[model samples]
Target: MGQQGRSRTNGQGGPGAVDGFFEYARERQLIKLRRDAGESPPFTGDPVLRAYRFCNVFREDDRTTAWFRQNVRDVLRESPTEVTLATITFRWFNRIEVGEQILDILLEDGWNAKRIRSRLRNVQPLVTGAYMVKTPPGMSKLEGIIWCMKHINRRSLPQMPMTSLELAHQWLTQYPYLGDFMAYEVITDLRHTFQLQDATDIMTWANPGPGAARGCEWITGHKYNRHSKTDRVAMMNVMRELLRLANSDEAFLWPEDWPRWEMREVEHTLCEYDKYMRAVNGQSLKRRFDASHQGEERT
Candidate 1:
């Protein structure tokens, strides 16, 4: 934990020490949210998978059936790592549909770097979504795909090493467009799709993305200060305590389908909280997966 977290905990003391920042939330009775019953499938028994499930932010009013996301549920049975790397490479600064389309191109072209470049050379550029993606000048979307392919090829591995999820994050973020959030996302993907790491593994770590950070603040009334090591440690601590409370004898249980949460899942819960609030409250930035389309909003 950082100095900020330690100070806060020390001031509050005991169980409330970690949770005291959110006294306002408790006063407002914001902890318990009304979620739809059995909207999606129950989380698989796999601990890691359950954790990943908790990461996704689903809302009761969301248009669950509006879009068809074939790619999300599609698991690569063969050449998993190659496909995983290809998917992550194409995913950066792009929408889910766009990324899936790019992935199809790579797969059809046999993951051939030059062939893909040649085919996509004259391809029309696409504009979708609101955010600006920073890429090198003259780098077409196809070229971006190739850049990732080459990047992964140099490493000679499909997914990152499972030994240290944190280390894998460091390795992936060294790339041009891949940042901390994207890297953590890729790590989550590897765990969810290819079973690269266990959800309950002590070394496994999933940092909340921007959405999760905002959600944490809204729900807890505490700013999830991204730049502060103390804040980061505090965030993890609160998540741990909250999950324990949710399943404890005191009976703060969640929905049956909600499943027991792990650390990664707790990280996900915060992100989803951010998304739910944005949509319900009509924030300027609406959710990318706007219930009109089914997709993974987070990378």
Candidate 2:
């Protein structure tokens, strides 16, 4: 047997091995179901592959970010109005096509909600239908843009500092409709524009979204408590330990082509796993993973 077959029943496993094993099995089951139904598999043939061509679908690569920064430099370099517009476009729709269309309309209609609403009325149904399940009280997407404008224009509110993710996200959350997830998105975008010192370090402080919470619960066999900071820390500890073992043990080795995962990347992977589980099994744990989190943005 190769390392994988030998390690499967060795009575020893790395921290992430259990999760990986389950995921591998689940993927195999999915493939079998698809074949039985006369449908194609969602990804490649290998159930155990950690990284694939589709890995970049959810996560941003360095090249993608760099290209994004260059293209938006003009908008980011100008007045805070432009920054507000760009951030709102991203937060509200998040989809590039929808966001770009609304942004173009905003430029033509001016920053206020009333004008944008009037101009976008034709496509309002489609746009509004695409919004997540819950929204800020009495706040539409157009209103969200205006709210961001007001916050950005406020002289009393300090500019988002590069090093302080907490302070930046806190300020963003004070605005209506800008929850933790949206705040993190805005701060991440602004960080690209700021070009400030320690910008790369801010991701380490990022709050995991609802999907990530669910993923963590599933991966840890429903043992991780999302509400407890101690449990969150424990999850990170487990990931780190698993990574260490994967590096040393051939049986636990991840995809050779894949780069080392940062903690934030691991969190991202958990979120993707959550989506995958929902599609494949729809078998959610009895405990509520989302109860402890605030400012959730679910799709």
Candidate 3:
């Protein structure tokens, strides 16, 4: 979406919303910190955070992601192809039930797309709203997904490249129906896996997803072009700069133990913060996870 494409929803959508990034970020982490420490219902004093949902500042800390790591990551560590296969397939749906079903098949039956299709066909909510899944004509979303999963080679595969998000994206987009945004999602998750531990790029470079892009627009006060490589780099620079400031500035109040933000953390936080700003303004952002709710949030 371009500058004209995204409008501030209400009175709160002015300079204040844009500038509240750090404070909002700090409060969010503190909210989770207190909640995890077993503090009561109100994890945050901020009304928007208390009532609505936002993902953790870090993706791995999100429940669905933790499930992925526990179930799929360790299981597939020895098999590079399996990591790629499972990560890509699980992320396509981004649903714990679906991921659980996939894990069962991958570890037991070994890539049974037919069973996956059958099980998901009658399921009320087949996939999470996290990623867009647009199937080709005449194919259900499951059918398109099964077709892609089948094409995943179980044999030795190409060398896993730990280069940049741009390159990983190029390779991942080769999967059927995995477009720019969705492929970017896969790439982010992969960075957390044992397979991509050497992935140096993700630490400093991240593909600015839509929410993050819009968030960057607010921060930079510049119209963002989601597809423009130049625009992505500009956003990357801004996020890195924020990470630097958040860690260095004592005036920037945050949890004492709040780990310094990486580029991906910065990216993830910006995206959620955008939804937060909009939600507080009375516009509905995609509701996912919260202190009381268990869910896989959206784009």
Score every model by TM-score: 0.61, 0.60, 0.84
- Please give, for residues 1-299, the per-residue lDDT of candidate 2 as tens digits: 12453244233234653545334434433433354476643433442222221123223342323333444434564444455455554455544344445555534322455654565555543332223523546776555455555554434334555456656677667766567776765666665454322455543455666666666665555566656899767766655553454334464444444445444555555665554444334344332322121111222
Mark the regions of model 3 whose C-alpha exceeds 4 Å error after superposition: 1-19, 108-110, 249-256, 286-291, 294-299
In model 2, the clashing pairs are none
Predicted candidate 1 versus true structure: per-residue lDDT over 1-299, tens digit per residue = 12343234332235443243232222112212212232343223222222221223322112210121234324352455554554465445345444444556545432566655564566555423333455557877666556755665534554456566666677777787667766665565565444354434533355766665665565456777876889877776667666665445554344434445555655666655454334334444443322222323333
Clashes of 2: 0
Which 10-residue span in candidate 1 carries the lowest summed lDDT?
Answer: 60-69
Evaluated against the true structure, the overall lDDT of model 2 is: 0.47
* TM-score ranking, best first: 3, 1, 2
Q: Candidate 3 clashing pairs? A: none
Give the 10-residue window scoring lowest on summed lDDT in candidate 2: 290-299
List candidate 2 segments past 4 Å from native. 1-43, 46-58, 61-85, 102-115, 125-158, 195-197, 236-260, 278-299
lDDT of 3 by residue, 1-299 (tens): 11222243323335544437766776677766787888887766666776678777777777888888788767776666667777777776778877765678756554677788776787657777766776667877788778777766666334556656668777777756778777777777666666566676766777677888888766766767878878877887888877776666564544456676667778878887778767766786556345575323642
- Assess the local accuracy of residue 203 in candidate 3 as a C-alpha lDDT between 0 and 100: 60
Instruction: Please report the candidate that would top TM-score against the real structure.
Output: 3
Better of 2 and 3 by TM-score: 3
